[model samples]
Target chain A: MASKASTLETEMPTEPTKRLDTFANPNPDRDYQIHIRIPEFTCLCPKTGQPDFAEMQLVYVPDEACIELKSLKLYIWSYRNEGAFHEAVTNRILDDLVAATIPRYMEITARFNVRGGLYTTVVARHGRPPASLERSDA
Target chain B: MLDEAGRRRGILAQAWPAGQSLSPAAWLRHALQLIALIRRRRPSAEIAAIAVDGTSGTTFLCDTTSGRPLTPVMAYNDGRAGIEARALAARGLAEGPASGPYGGPAKLLWLTRHYGAPSGAGIAAQASWLSGALLGHYGLMDEHNALKLGFDGSWTQILRERPFTVRLPHVVPAGTPLGPLCRTLTRRLGLRSAPLVVAGTTDSTAAFLALGSLPVGCGVSSLGSTLVLKIESPHPISVPEFGIYSHRLPKTWLVGGASNSGAAVLAHYFDRPTLARLSATLPLPTSPRLDYYPLLAPGERFPVSDPRLAPRLSPRPADDRLFLQGLLEGLAAIEARGYALLARYGAPRLQRVVTTGGGATNGAWRAIREQALEVPISLAADRPAAFGAARLARAGWLDTR
Candidate 1:
């Protein structure tokens, strides 16, 4: 019976923050998957200092705690001005999210825009989904 | 009108009509509008004096006797007199202000050529004509406006040597009292009495006067759409190659230049709300080391006067806040370079900087500028050019008495 304002007040951070937040999972006993599509991820290219834009897909299965959506968004925004290679940034994101939520399984797939006539996609993962929840999409 | 202590008793402003062409009738209308507003707000108030300040180089030809415009205004930024400017430079007026296409003399030449120089037509700076309209007199222009019109104290020697067939206005120092406001305007606007119409100055000089007074070596950086840096110097310095010139003040020279980079480029990317929000979030000591020359287009004046110079705003970072910081840093660097150039050209070394215009309100930008300038920075008085004009009017009225 949460009011819309009350829900938003509880959920959204007052300002952009780099610290990711987590809440105890509502249904920790269940084996459901959480899929997040971040369409506006950006970071600087390490060598050239030019911007590199990418779309990221994060899929994870919760163990006991769930990553807070708004905090995760802000966490992703923190890398916007940082210079990092595509492979490195994707792995770093996966590591940070895994460390925060301590999920049973997590994966980050980043598809970057074309540069110098080449498009790059980097995929990084931690742990594995339970055998019963395994899928070919990965 | 301001009190003896220089505090405003009343103030009003009217927006100029939107157009490329300047209209004398519009100027009169706006003046009347301001007068009526003042009368409405403070019926008991007695306006003692009035003055006008206009863009330094904007000028047009007007009938000598009738005070009617003979040609459209050549705006301060208009550059249609390139050939005439080059011709003047070829004749050895190269180092003077009048050799620029946007300067008053070159534009006057262009007007004469296209409009067919008629007899009884005299040139008028925007401020001169507006002031004359109030006094029912024409042909008396202040020295600040007259500078760009080839008058440095005396009509520039070259102009005196080859004199134009077109008449030149009698130049007076700024704050000179011309006469009383015409009886017709006094009655039409319902003033208690005719106030003295003082000879005014160029707008930048008016802005400087708004700061009350500053010692030599104090610089005023106007962070408007373009960055203009003016410093008070003991002696005149003129370096036309760097697009630098000096306007003669009562006791000192106001030396400066304008650059193409400033808050306009920030506006190109961020609106007010976004700018404020991003500005607040910007980390202190916000040097991203992005060497961006954030020009609106490919030309620069002052510090680097190359007409074909391209803007250098590449390697833009992904974060909006970081990009904003980079732009601010670039502007601060340009301002520093401007002061350095002025000093190199024999102007006084800047001891302090007072910031004016829209960008003055930005705290983050101010911090960045202080770091770059290596001088104490302060905000200007929250007064417009009109306030400075009122100060001039007060001085002129007192002098006449």
Candidate 2:
């Protein structure tokens, strides 16, 4: 009979990581969109060192590679204790994603919660959408 | 709660729910659950009083008029107020319990700056807020919890000197009766009568009280998520640089410091069952000889109070059992150094160490700790912090009669 402890040793989750990971896109020949929503994004305020929370929406059209889900989650978690402004952090996420996947079109929108009677939202974009996608939307 | 003859009638323990922040709603839910469980188990038993103990520096803002939470809880280990702590220190408020980023004063400043203090805003500790919730009022705070809020037997002076805009709680001694539980709770919980709500100490202090009695030279090591070391001393000691401070008791002062290294570091790498299994197979004569300072993150609080201290878990060995031994040995070494540091800072020399918390049950770890500490290690008779809170409740109820 196998003990529960012995069984659990082999099923442990991987440690959190800071590096973004990607895999080869399944349909690189065709142009399609991917939307990822991270509801539990949290970072620290650069000035006061207090925690700042946001809901991140990432929309991109993959070219040669696509971002891996678990790796993206870990990458986001790596910033839990880091201190950065909303604008800088939002732009940095888009930049990192673009660098990892080299997507044809990538956009990141961060909706930060209200702090001191002010709500902050930052949007960053990389590359341009294809004319075909614009025409389809129209 | 314990009866007059000091025999336990009923007891219950509940873990904090997963993915739940330490908010007022979560606290009330747990409190009600525990009360209901105890009542169901011992229906005929008459409850006399209730006291609540929480982490020493855990605090949040609340509305004074409505007793409503206005901000999220700043946990005891939250180090986001480093800037505010430094600012306070620069203003010559350095030599007290509230001198670090984890202190209540810094958290309050951070909350005020970020949340914007309203007209009826006030600060509340976990124990105070819970007790107030029971009493339908919210201004009272125990002295032990207030210690980290810069309360040194003088709230008026502290308020006059500091630049806080929120209303500070009225601090009282532990075991002091605040009031009877509100009638609504009695009816809702189906209790025969409202129990007196007693002021409670911090969780660690409450644990200290659970120890039946200890001599001046005796020490207690709490191996919970963090390594907390407290020794009974004739005089209070304060060393803010090393994160050492003293909590006042009726007869003696408990001088101690907490380390960032403890069982939580092990929990990061292995589950509880895995830890127990691996610990059973480790060689007991000597440690794996890996000089590792295990930390979950980059900061340390005691024995070395550098906020930027990096963990030294490198020079990896392939064997998981060896690695577990190394981590256990590292924690034991930290415990030794913590006691040594406390002694260096005017605390009483440790004659014996009474161990408490989850790690106390590990015989292998205990043997290693005894070897490192050079003192006899004994497991506490009662390990739960609630038992101590119940003791406080019993004492307060007796005094009133």
Q: Native contacts recovered, in order, as a fraction for each? A: 0.00, 0.00
Candidate that scores best on lDDT: 1
lDDT of 2 by residue, B225-271 (tens): 88989998889887878888888776678899889899999899989
Model 2 TM-score, all chains together: 0.67
Residue B233 of model 1 has an lDDT of 87
Off by over 4 Å in 2: A1-138, B13-21, B29-40, B93-96, B155-163, B187-190, B269-274, B284-290, B318-322
Tens-place lDDT digits, model 1, residues B1-401: 57543445656777666872388878877887888898898788777888999988999999988889889888898999999888877877765566678877778878878886678988898899989999988989999889888887677655544446778789988999899899999999988899888989989889877655554466889999999999988898888889898877777888999898999999999999999999997655545688999899998887888877899887888988888988998999999999999999899888667678999878789878878898656555455777778888888888877
User: What value of lDDT does candidate 2 attain over all alpha carbons?
Assistant: 0.81
For candidate 1, lDDT tens digit of each residue in A38-130? 999999999999999999999887754688898888888888899999998887677556645656678888999999999999988776665
Superposing every Cα of model 1 onto the true structure, what RMSD results?
A: 21.4
Q: Which is the leading candidate under TM-score?
A: 1
